[model samples]
Target: MRFRGLLLGLFLLPAVVGAYLLAGSATEDGTPRCDGIIEEYGDAERSGPMKPGETCDLYDFADGRSQGTRSYDQQRKAQEAKASKDGLVGGVCLVYGLAGACAVIAGRRAAPAPPGSRRRPETAPRSRRGGQAPPIGSMSTRTGVPHTRSTS
Candidate 1:
């Protein structure tokens, strides 16, 4: 039984170690897909082919500007509509955010703090000696001495 268990473990060790070694190095390559728009592939027009290191990005006139790879022939109209809608929605969100920020600034400047609401409180001073604040103990651990707090 012991030898059988040993043999099983030895067989599994390489697989386990290999899995660990591979787990740390796995990465995804994000390549923009060109599909649906063009069924048959053909050479790009006089615009020339994209450079070796270059990526494609379709232009969005409504969105103002964009940078990335884009396809014209195979590209669908829906993508354009979606991109425009996304930009409009993003603009609205930015306007709301700016309004909220302005409101916060105006409120801080115009509104007064509530009456008698203390903002800062005095803090206790630290002892110059770098040691634990002596415990308020009644009986000393080393000697049987009673500790007391002076009121006078």
Candidate 2:
């Protein structure tokens, strides 16, 4: 039992560790670059955040900048999705690890019987002839009636 518990713990340890790492990453700030800028490029010079030195001459009426960028809501939603996924995986791993540890501890503990405790005899009860049990439906010599097996 102890060996089996050890094996179980070893196998499930990775899952627990992975969940912790994922949850930790999810908790960090995930804000993206160029959040407030709302400039739709006419010629579509840039599709994402560009370097400060990069020249994008396309006129954007919204933010007056040519570089295209994601809105704040989009970045926030993506972060939330990642966080939720990580949280779910971490929760499952935590629960499984705890249950497995409990099982291992329980298996290692021995039953609390005293050293001199009396135990029930293992030998089967002997009939008058000191032989094996009679077959079912056999008539008893003393009763002399067909052995109608008791339902109870």
Candidate 3:
């Protein structure tokens, strides 16, 4: 059983690493963007207003002018959804890694002796007379038993 656990842990190690890598790859950049229509006010000296659904920095909307738009709400929801997904993936990977570590540690522990293979230490039999007891089937008997011939 211990050997089996060791093998299982070894096999799971590679899988856990692979899973962690995969999760890492799926993660998005830490940049938060506006998913709604960005309406930027600019004069002839600057570029025109941002197009619909264009990525915009959250700082641009810090003035609170566009906070009530549907685009802002959509951006917030998207960010929240991504955060939840990332958290879940990280949690799963952590749990898997912990389980694999436990399995390896448990497998390394000493195995128990097989049934009937253990030997008990030899001990002398107990006697009421405080001496070694007689051999089995001897004429001498225990005090509790009545002898066929009476001492009288």
Off by over 4 Å in 1: 1-74, 117-152
Error of 3 at 107 (Å): 1.0
In model 3, pairs of residues that clash are: none
Candidate 2 off by > 4 Å: 11-15, 18-26, 33-70, 111-152
Candidate 1, position 49, lDDT: 37
Tens-digit lDDT track of model 1 for 19-39: 443332222122223321222
Q: Give the C-alpha miss distance for residue 142 in model 2, angstroms.
A: 30
List TM-scores for all candidates, in order.
0.31, 0.40, 0.35
Candidate 3 ranges with C-alpha deviation above 4 Å: 1-39, 43-70, 111-152
Positional deviation of residue 100's Cα in model 3 after best superposition, in angstroms: 0.8
lDDT of 3 by residue, 1-152 (tens): 56767776675765676566556646744444554344455522222233345444433345645434434345556766766676677667666776776666675565555677766866643443556554544443446443244359
- Per-candidate Cα lDDT values, in order, are 0.45, 0.58, 0.55
Pairs that clash in candidate 1: 37-74, 56-68, 56-69, 56-70, 57-68, 57-69, 57-70
Candidate 2 structure, TM-score to reference: 0.40
RMSD of each: 22.3, 12.9, 13.0
* Angstrom error at residue 51, model 2: 13
Per-residue C-alpha lDDT of model 2 across residues 1-152, encoded as one tens digit per residue: 45766767774795677578566756656553343333344444333453433332334668676544334555556556767777777777777776777676665565454566786646643333565556677766766675564679
